[model samples]
Target: MFSSKTLAEMDRNIAKYPPEQKQSAVMACLIAAQEEHGWVSPAIIAEVAGILDMPTIAVEEVATFYNMYETKPIGQFKLVICTNLPCQLSHGEEAADYLKKKLGINFNETTSCGTFTLKEGECMGVCGDSPVLLVNNHRMCSFMSHDKIDALLDELKSQAKKGVSA
Candidate 1:
């Protein structure tokens, strides 16, 4: 269910590299597929392999290795809570607990309203701002407070309900 624009973008990405190097475009193609469907299906991965003249296993490797690739349905917004050492030291698990308590959904689960999905991620490279959480892949730079998380969760719900961002 990929759109023409996305296919064209993938083709352009392929053109940017030599024909023999289509493997280099694997990441872009997978991302394009992900953007269209929110998750990468096995069928699409096989199609990508055929498009790139590579093996399906090669495509799967790329998809599984990358943190950005999602294999399951995520909500309209994905709240990835970083729980690595730096984040934990800075109250990362606390934020995750807050989300679970507030949204009534644990890690790797979507909220009952389908407005948000909570994912447990590793260090998001914001050690300086250690307890960071990502919303729909957008880096939210501050953390350290449960109220901020409550506001974020509330805003996401409001946005989903209205079909507009809050």
Candidate 2:
């Protein structure tokens, strides 16, 4: 169910391990599948398991264990706010509350417009940059203040209107 490019990528990842250890590429394959499909559905999980020659449960374990992998469909912009101790010590709670009020959605919830998904996250390895967030699980936004969050939301809304992803 993956594109040829993704299959090729999986092949390359699989080649990294010895012949009998194809399962070593399970995470890579799952990531490729997610990149293609936007989320890891049961079908994608099964396809990954088939490609890795591993049990479906094994793939499921990896998918479920990792917070980075989206198990369900998410909005175009997934805003992950760090809520760990360091972040809490900062204005993380205020930022999250601001987001919730601004977007009218709680953590782990997607906005009604399907433009954003808010998630509570653990430490993103940047404790000093408290009140930090990750966009689409890739772009790191640090030291978010209220005004900065508003600017970001406006920018993302503009991007969404233009049918572009950030």
Candidate 3:
């Protein structure tokens, strides 16, 4: 379920398409729902399908197909590191390993405090910015050397201490 504000946002997204083609707004609606709920659950998917006049399975298909959509609950800060071939050659693996060591969690694992989740991701389309890390699927940190990575971790930890979302 979503808040009224999120529902209003979804309505706005639906309004972008013709009345008869409102189903085209499925992705936007799902994104709005995920933003509110932090993940796309089956009930949320069904609700989105109902709003868009789509089948629940269709909405599920979209959510499952996109790596950006979190079907399962994730930690507050989702750290997705790019590990494609180009990035791997540019210390992406090194960055990933450092994160694992620093966080004491491997890929697809969340920290015990539930403050951070680390995931290995595909190319973020910025090969030049290898060792790029995406925070909560939005903020992008590129050219992550060891010092930079340490600074980032400290900043995130500080944010967590301050009860800030990053």
Candidate 4:
């Protein structure tokens, strides 16, 4: 379960709308819980259900349906790769192979350094930007090559070390 503060925030999420539309807060509530916990735990899903006045199964259904929400813990930099139609058509599998080799881990596994975790994804809705990866859920890496991926890892490591030292 989340702390009282998170529950209060969940309350405010639904309060913004009329009481009848509390279900609208379900997604936001799950996102909030996921953001706090780094992965949506069963308890967090139940709490979200309690917040939105929804059945636990309904919440679970939504959480499980979305690839964006992780049932298991992810790493610091979540490297999400696209394997949908467009991405696959445009070398997505090759990109995945490169990533797996470079990271020394297969899909759905985290690197030993704990810097990243690999996630094989469906359409990220950026089909045009096929063969894309999202780092830290903020930086988007697209049209990747093995060398480019290596550079990216180096840069991220440097940035993280800098932040730690600071």
TM-score of each prediction: 0.91, 0.97, 0.96, 0.83
Better of 1 and 2 by TM-score: 2
Q: Rate the local accuracy (lDDT) of all candidates.
A: 0.83, 0.93, 0.92, 0.81
lDDT of 3 by residue, 43-161 (tens): 99999999888989999999999898989988888999998999999999999999999999999998999889999998899999888999998899999998999999999999999
lDDT of 2 by residue, 1-166 (tens): 7889999999999999998999999998988888888899998999999988899999999999999899999999999999998999999999999999999999999999999999999889999998998998779999999999999999999999999887
Error of 3 at 118 (Å): 0.9
Cα lDDT tens digits for candidate 1, 76-134: 88888888898888888888788888888888899776778888888778787867888
> What residue pairs are clashing in model 2?
none
Separately for all candidates shown, the number of backbone clashes (residues 3 or more apart, or on different chains) is 0, 0, 0, 0
Measured on C-alpha atoms, candidate 3 has an lDDT of 0.92
The candidates, ranked best first by lDDT, are: 2, 3, 1, 4
How should the candidates be ordered by TM-score, best one leading? Answer: 2, 3, 1, 4
**Candidate 3 vs candidate 4: which has greater lDDT?**
3
Q: Write the per-residue lDDT of candidate 4 for residues 49-162, one digit (tens) a residue.
A: 887889999999999997778888877678889888799899899999988988899999998877779988767678777678877566777777777788887887787666
Q: Whole-model lDDT, candidate 2?
A: 0.93
Task: Give the runs in model 1 whose Cα sits over 4 Å from its true position.
Answer: 164-166
Best by lDDT: 2
TM-score: the better of candidates 2 and 4: 2
Candidate 1 lDDT score relative to the true structure: 0.83
